[model samples]
Target: MKHEKRWAIVSLASIPLVMTLGNSMLIPVLPTIEKKLNISSFQVSMIITLYSIVAIILIPIAGYLSDRIGRKKVIIPSLLIAGMGGIVSGWAAWKMDNPYILILIGRVLQGVGAAGAAPVVMPLVGDMFKSEKEVSKELGVIETSNTFGKVLSPILGSLLAGLVWFLPFFAIPIFCAISILLMLFLVKSPKMKKPVPFKKFFKTIKKIFKKNAKWLIAIFIIGCILMFVLFGVLFYLSTMLEDEHKIEGVKKGLILAIPLASLCIASFVTGKKIEENKVLMKWLTFIGILLSAGSVFAISFTENIYFLISIFFICGMGIGVALPCLDALITEGIEKEERGTITSIYSSMRFIGVASGPPLFVLLMKASHQVMYYTVTGICILAAIIALVGIKPKEIK
Candidate 1:
């Protein structure tokens, strides 16, 4: 039974790797898609934004359904839909040669499927692990898989794009397929000794929120701001590489992969430390925002590509250190029964930042490089203020 439970955690952890790969894997391929389709910068940016839009719309619904039906039931279908979407996008990229519409449609599908997989995985982890310590440890493993996918996807996606621009789209389906199999074979839903009544369940949810609404909202906003700052920088850097530096395809992939590598390393280290101390987590998050804000500032000061890349890497490390702690904080704050709904809300706020980041950053870039830094910097300051004011350490557990 113990082995079964551990295997279940490992299996569920794979869901994020499969779903997020479709999102991050496409980053390196973005420049290729632009060339293939001859789309404008705004249109190229739309592919990413559209994916987030779909997720933002669907995540709460998926989370609600997971609560109603069961996590496994919703998750399996979500993977299948996302995989089909990937295959369709690849075919469209190949046949129509109009990368824009095909990729957009594919991304929408990926988002819908991805919506169910990512938001639910955390709640599932909550349901499985009984102890705070165990939950923290598993959250670390889960967070690692999530960041690892981000790290590896760009490298692999870039390599695939080298062979064929459309390959990354098709490649995601294979991962989804594997995840589906593992989920079905190895993952099992825990038997609930007693289920909550609908009225009581709603009352319980309200009570939890009533107790911690302020902190919950603060953490959600902080996560959103962090995502906003992180992705905004990434979008700006990707464009700078292709437009200013004249880097494309595999070279673009290599440059982008540098910061993601930092993100992967930092996520693993921070997850452990955060489990031990919320005060430390709070300080680390503040520092992460500082590092990220500094990176955006650094980009404005330098025309040197190496320095620009270094700043982006520093920002990614800040995000990496901050993300798991955010997850751990939310998990620690909520009761087990409410985990699905609360995590869903948390995921939605993060997607809101993601969905908005690119277009907002791109728009700011038109004004000046300094504008981009200031915008992200302002967001970080807001997040920092919330952390300082709203998150009381004693209340986390």
Candidate 2:
């Protein structure tokens, strides 16, 4: 029980790793999915959107259920559902031969499972750690876990898809299984006496709406805008490499990884510093947004892969520095009980941004790649402005 805190952090952190891996692994293998399914590019885009749509719907419900039941109970089953979805998806990909439908099915189920676990995990972390400092550090670790998954996912997906079309689907179940094991062994939640009444729950929401609506709105919107900018740029970068530069296989993986690598390093460092100063956190985030915008803006001017990859690393680093702090600031401000609900709302906004980014950016690129990149650059700059001006930490009740 002494190292309960460390164990809890590890367990809570693993949940995001599983979730991120499942969501990102498809990026490298999107072309394979299109080839196998013989679907239009527009339809393939839905494979990603459908999952986000499901998470958007289910996240609030999951948060409410976790509050009523228990965090661990909800999380464990959610992992199982996600793992099972992976299995079904793999099987569907192999047996049905229509990879698109099967992938969508799997993504839908994964989304359902995602709703239950992803939003609740951070609140569980909040439950385990009392110190605002510890919460900030732990949230950094959790965000790192998410990026770590991104760092590994493309390589894993590329290797797996290289082996077989269905193999990438299997990676999800495996990650979920590992997450389930960690949650079972490591995460220990305090008991709750009774579920909050629906009437009271709504009243609390209304109260929060009236009081902290600005912060709540800002954080969620910021979360959404941040993800939109991050992923939209990623989508554009990947396509630029694949279609224009003609990079493929492991080389493509490494070039793509430059950004994620930068992000990983920034996340770890920012995590270390966040608790010491709120102003530092605010400035770090603001600077990160500036770096992100600058890097993308630079990438727009370059047709050279070398120039593009270098600027992308800077962009990635900025995003990396910004994300953990953003997560910490948002969840750290809320009470433990309300963390799940608020975090869910924040995550839903993030999913909305992420869901919109790929297709919308893809459309913009159809017109002009420069326009697409500039649009995302503007969004990141706006997000930076919002974080700098909108967020002012409050005393915890």
Q: Which candidate number would show the highest TM-score if scored against the true structure?
A: 2
Model 1, span 226-312: residue lDDT tens = 777766667777778888998877778778878988987888888766665778778887788777777776667776998888878
Q: What is the TM-score of each candidate against the true structure?
A: 0.95, 0.96
Pairs that clash in candidate 2:
none
**Which lDDT tens digits does candidate 2 get at residues 183-258?**
8887789766576788988788788767877666767777888787766766677677788887765567666777
**What's the residue-level lDDT of 203 in candidate 2?**
88
Best by lDDT: 1
Model 1 misplaced regions, further than 4 Å:
1-3, 97-99, 193-199
